[model samples]
Structures are given as C-alpha cells and as structure tokens.
Target: MELKGKIAVITGASSGIGALTAHLLGQRGAIPVLLARSEDKLRAAAERITGEYGLYRCDVSNSGEVEETIAKIIAKYGRIDILLNNAGFGRFADFIEMPVEEFGEMMNVNYMGVVRCTKAAVPHMLERGRGQIVNVASMAGKIGTARSAAYTASKHAVLGFTNALRQELRYSGITVSAVNPGPIETEFFKLADPSGDYIKNVGGFMMTPQYVAERIVKLIEKDKEELDLPRLAAAGIRLYGLFPRLADKLTYKMLNRK
Candidate 1:
C-alpha cells in the first residue's frame, strides 16, 4: 500500500477533503486521477498537484459516466492501485418535510455513487490482485443526527458497504478502509445550510480539510481499515452508540432548539 508512484483515483476531487487529498497524494508520489462534476474546479485541483494527475469531469451519481470514466483511467494507466470514493452530498431537513427527490439525490450521490465507482474499479483490482479502496464516510454514519435523516442513512450505508468490501477482499491482497470524519469546514456545510447557523453552532469543532487529508494518507500507507479524526468526536460517536436514546435527546435539544 505504498503511495509512492501508485495510481490513485479520487472522486469529488474538486474541493474540500477530496481536493486536499489529491494534493497530498500527489506530494506522496501517487498519480492522482481527479473526478468531479465541475471541470473548472477539477482543472484547478489537478494543476495544483505536482505529480502525474488526470482530471475527469463526471458525476458519480451517473453509473454510465462513472463506469466509462474509470474504464478510461484503467485503460490509460494500466492499473489502479487506490480508489477513493469520496464524492457525496448532504441535505438537512426534517424527514417529514424532506422531498422525495432530495432523498433520492442524497442516496444517489452518497451511497450509490460509492457503489458505482467501486463496481467499476473492483474488477480491475481483482484482475491485478492488489488495490486499496477508501470510502469517506462521516460521524453521521456512526450515529443519527438531527435534521439529517437522508444524510445519516447514506453514510450508514457507506460504513456497511466498506465493512462488507473489507471482508470480501481480505485474502485478495486488496485493502478496504472507511474514513469517518466529524464536521469539517468545507463546501458541504454551505450546501447543507447556507444561512450560516449550522456553521455558528457546529463550526467550533470543525477540522480543516488538510488535517483529514493527512490522516487519509496515513491510513493508505498503514492499510488501516478505519480512521476517525479528532479523538473527542470519535469518543462521542462511541458514547452515542452505547446510549442512543440519550444521545438523540441531547442532540435534539442542542441542534433542534435553535
């Protein structure tokens, strides 16, 4: 799992954790393939990377596009050593008030997007008999959060998917890891809440994208199955798992009251 000169494909590489990770991976000598819906942002990110980098404008939500794009990458590079399923989106709304299409969008991007990209890359990895897959989940994946029903469900599925992939590929010389990050200051927050209230309340504990990127590189090198950033948040997630009802009550009181 050495990153040096490895061929890595990172989805949602336009900004946030994906963009930072592309830079970090390039610095580590990995050839990064940047995939995102935004050609402008992808170009900028690829330009910033020092090593070999490719920019592909494709939405992860589109199965055909993802399949075609990954095929092109493999055809060009001859092998994919790392596949990072990091493309996702979030929508915060009461479950009852959330639109059906919004739920579909969340599932499509956060859950199915991972599925599509993984499906495209796994065959190549199996043929090569070696690869690493990293799914960027969230703290919400570990526990339900207020006004994030769809987002939480998508992330939970991501955790489940990564776990399954890890078990299935245990003897295949391929590694599957899930990086569960707490709140990080990124464009995702703005998409979740443009008003800045969510920022004011949750922003205090938010980690920078570069910090998460550093951890991702470490996980790739160590072949760790899961990496949780910010020790306090990891502790909170474990506690929430132990006391779901109490955690729900506290979260509702803290986030819903505002």
Candidate 2:
C-alpha cells in the first residue's frame, strides 16, 4: 500500500528492524507510531526519524497495556494502515535444560505479544476494511534446529496465527503477511547467546536488518502471502520440510562448519 500519510504502528520499535522501519517509513511519508517497553529508547528512535511520528511505551506482553496504548493511538490517528509485529527475543539452550520460566517468557513476548497488539489494532482495520498486518516470524519457525527450541516454538506459533488470520481475511481488504527471515545482524544475538557461542559461530552469515526491513516495506505494497529471505535459506527450509532426515544431516554439517 502507499505509505504516504498512512498511519503505521510498529512494535519492537526501540531498535533493530523496528527502529530501522520507523525511520524508513517516516521517509516514505508514513506517520509511524513507535511502540516498545523502553521509553528512552523509543524517544531516541523517534527522534531519528525525519518526518512526523510518535512513540508509546508499550510492553506487548501486557494485554492491558497493549489494549490501552493501541486504543490511544487509534483514537488519535482514526485509522491504522499497517501493524508490524516485530517485538521478540531468543536464547540458545538445550530444551531439557531450559527453564520453564524462560520458555513461558518466550511465549509471552514472542508469540502472545503479536496476539495482543493484533487483537487491539485489527478491529480498527476491520472497520476500515483496509490494512496490513505483517508478523516478523523467523526462519527458525519453518526449520527447527538444536539450541533454540523455545525461540523456534514461539515463532511457529506466530506463523500459525498469521496464516489463520490471512485465511479469515481472504475476501476482505485487510491483508495478513508473514516475513520469515534468517538471522539478521542485531542485538538479538547478545540477548540470545550471552555466552556468545551462537554469535561467534553462526552470526557471520547473518542478513542485514536494513535489507530485511526494506523488503518488508516492499512486500506490503504487493499481494504476497509470505516472504522467506536469503533465498538459499528458503531453499534449505523447503528441503527440510520435504526430507527431514537429509536436512538434519546437512544442517549438522553446516552448523559445524568453520
């Protein structure tokens, strides 16, 4: 959709993909509303945008906060043209050793955050019968691997929800799309692997967050259902779906390489 004058709400807007999108969207003439838990960071991010914008301190995992924050935004803008669900975090751990609390936190922020924001914003979109909901799921959701079970599970839930919503809105003007990208260069690694094993080993192959953000903005202007970035990774994902055993062997070698 044309971003000019469009009211766009971006979750996880404090940094990384969300922050970059906020700046880029503002450049495209969209009035970007930034949402995240950090007020300071949100303010800083909004300041970096060159056009008109606003920021809200929102913890997407909190239903009441998301509901109230989103309501205020809608009340002011009167219409929302885009909702980008990008607030998420991850960690590397053996499932058996991962704490239940950490797993629940993943579900809360990574999966339920999307649900909460979407729940609040979608009704407004439905009223207008024109909007875009883009969930930033991960390649991990499509192809599981060792060391990130909880993270993968949360993203899988996101894709499931996105697919269901897209089908439900199939005949309507509202569109739901999922962007499944491989690892991008971001603070996520420090958050995911404080010990740095995952970053030191696999991070070099990461995609640039700017590249992913640009592609997402372009996809929203199209009729695409989903986007799997880094075409090679997309191909590998398809292979894993078709031949799990072969994929397991290949992935083991790939991850161990270097």
Candidate 3:
C-alpha cells in the first residue's frame, strides 16, 4: 500500500525499529500514530517526525490500556490504514536458570501484545476494506538457540500467529506480514543479556536500525508476506532447516572456533 498520507498506528513507537519506521513513514507522507508505554520517550520520538502525528501512551501488555488507546485512536481518526506490531523485549538466559514467571512476562509482552492490539484495531480496518499489518518478529522466531528460552519461544509464537493470521485474512482486504531480522544495534541487548557475554559472543555483526527500517518500508510498499534481513543469514537458516544434521555440525564448528 502507498504510505503517502496513510493513517498508520505503530506499537512500540518509543524506540528502536518502531521509532525509525515512524520517521521514515513521516518522510513518505504518512501520519504516524505512535503508541508505547513511555509517554516522554514517545513524544520525543514523535517530534522527530517531519509532520503532525498522533501519540498515545499505551502499554500493549495491558489489555485495558491497548483497548482504551485503540478506541481513542478510532474515536478521533475514524479509520486505520496500517497497524505495525513492533512493541517487544527480550530476556536472554539459560532456560534452567531463568525463572518460570519470566516466560509469562515475555510472552505477554512479545506475543500477546500483538494479539491485543490487532484484536482492537482490525475491526476498523475491516470496515474500511483495506489495511496493512506488520509484525516485527526475530530470526530467533525462525530458529532456536542457546541462552534465549523465553525470548525465542515468544518470538516463535509471534511467527506462528502472523503466519496463521495471514491465511485467515487472505480473502479480506487487509494484509499481514512478519519482519524477522538478526541482532541489530540497539539497547535491547543490554537489557536481554546485561552480562555482555551474548552481545560479545553470539551477537556477532549487527545491522543498523535505519537499514532494517528501510527494508521494512519497502516490504510495506510491496505485497510481501515474510521478510528476513541479511540475505546470507536467511539463506543459511533455510539451508539449516533442510539439513539439520549438517547444519548442527557447521554451527558447532563456527561456535567453537577461536
């Protein structure tokens, strides 16, 4: 869909990919409606956009907050042209060491947050007969790894939900897609890892948020279902899925290498 003058509501708009997407969309003439838990940061991010935008303080994990904020957006704007479910966080730790409650917290914010916002916004989109939905999942969602039990599981659920949602919306005017990317240069790691080991070791090379946002802008413009960045890495994942035993050997060699 053309982004020019479109009414786009983005969750997690206070920082990272969501914030970057809002800036780019504004440059392309779309009215970005920013939603996040922090009002201060959300306002700061919205101000950077080149045009007038909407800012709604919302915690996507809270059902009442998501419901109320979305209702407010519709009450004022009348319709939503695009919905970007980008609000999420990660907690990386050995599965055995991580508390079980952490899993619930992670899933509530990462996976169910998308469900809550989508459930609230989709009705208006349906009434309008045209809309776009983009869920920012992760490469972790596509494949599992060590030190990311809660995070990987939450993202996996996101991928599953997005895929199924696409099929359910097939006959409708609304479009659904997922953006899965490897690690990016962001504060997410400091929160997820904290000890600096994962970022130092497993994180490897990182993609700039601006670069990923550019690709996502293209994805929104075109009718694409799934987008995974860093073509080489995505290709490797595909290969690994096809040959798990060989992929395991290669992964072991790469990880063990000095």
Per-residue C-alpha lDDT of model 3 across residues 88-190, encoded as one tens digit per residue: 9998777889999999999999999999999998888888888989999998887677778789899999999999999998888999999999888877877
Mind giving the per-residue lDDT tens digits that candidate 2 earns over 146-205?
A: 878899999999999999999999878889999999878889887787876666676667
How many clashes show up in model 3? Answer: 0
After superposing candidate 3 on the true structure, give the runs of residues whose Cα lies further than 4 Å from its correct spot.
202-204, 253-258
Q: Which stretches of candidate 2 lie over 4 Å from their true place?
A: 255-258
lDDT of 1 by residue, 1-258 (tens): 678889999999999899999999999899999999999989987778997889899999998999899989988999999999999989788889999999889989999999999999999999989999999998889877678889989999999999998999999989999999988889987788777787788666779999999999999999999988788878877888899888878777554521
What would the TM-scores of all predictions be? 0.95, 0.96, 0.95
Error of 3 at 229 (Å): 1.3
Q: Please give the range of 10 consecutive residues that has the lowest summed lDDT in model 1.
A: 249-258
* Collision pairs in model 3: none
